[model samples]
Target: MSNDVKRPSGRHHGDLRRVLEEAALELVAEGGPKACTLAEVSRRAGVSVAAPYKHFADRDSLLAALVQKGYAEQRDRYVAAMKRKVEPAEQLAAFARAYVEFAAEQRPMFELTFAAGLDKTKYPELLNAGAELFEVLREPARNLRNTEAGSRDLVLAVAAAAHGLAVFVLEGVLLNVSQAKDLAASSARAIV
Candidate 1:
């Protein structure tokens, strides 16, 4: 019943870090957050149980690293997705679509990245990275800011909507990915 996937050989420091992340991601995907343990990840990663501590101070530290990595990846994708010069409305739509796509593709990491109960104050770097990801939406959101002074609220609303839409689509509420994309696009247009 192990969900461990095979990894390629010739790993370096970066590769080992990625291996740990991948193992944790697989565990989260199979079970929930509780499934991701230092020992379990070490076992799946083919490392000594004590090995993870060398990379991660503890379970929270590992989770923090995963969250930061996930946010960084998502941020990169969002930036790349916005490279085209489209209508503001279409740009926002594309951004929303991209958000859901990232969520769908990286569900386990996404969940860990956004999960509550983590002390953002204790993890300033992760908090800053996560904030920077959200900042990518500010361009499309700026169009809506003039009419509404609540820019922060608008950004949070759009993000929450995208996250909820992704959860719904992943949970089988939306039967089709295309349909989900359309819904997200339309929702972004309406909300932003």
Candidate 2:
């Protein structure tokens, strides 16, 4: 059966780009980055295969846009998760949990966001958007009573641990670490 969910069939000429991007997102969500093709996105958006060329050069260009969109969403979630707690350590824990949860929940998008061959020079916006997630962690690390380098090191350590757990969850290799929140909270407690 076709996994393509029914999308808005009627789009204004000006909204085609947005429609195409939404279609591409759905495609990626269902089957990861390689599944997102310009032709498939156009068809899902109820447009001609040629339509996407007006907005995107090729599959990579569209994927780049998707990466930016994914980062922006992750960054927003990180900000909101951090705001729920006043304590720095709590906020850090929240950030870590959110990161891992995002990976598990939006597995395909998360995979594409970190995919190799994503040339940052060509897509600077993606880099800037992704940086926001790190900034949230950095803010909470300031309360750890460390020098600049020490704080940086702490943030990296925490991120590395969280990412490792997230990867394990995504790969389904670890049977014990099933819950993203619990694993993330445990890792956070150990560090903070």
Best by lDDT: 2
Worst 10 residues of 2 by lDDT: 3-12
- TM-score of each candidate? 0.85, 0.84
Local distance difference test, candidate 1: 0.78
RMSD of each: 5.0, 5.0
Residues 1-192, candidate 2, lDDT per residue (tens digit)?
576765455653888888888888788777777788887888788888888989899888888887887888888888899899899878878878888888888877788888635788888887787677677678778888467776677788788878888888888865554476777867886887
- Model 1 earns a TM-score of 0.85
Give the Cα error of residue 4 in candidate 1, in Å.
26
Write candidate 1's Cα lDDT for 1-192 as tens digits. Answer: 466864457333557777887888889899867788889998888877887877888888888888888888888887777677367666777877888888788888778877624688989998799778767777677766774446667777777877788889778888677777778878978986
Native RMSD of candidate 1 (Å): 5.0
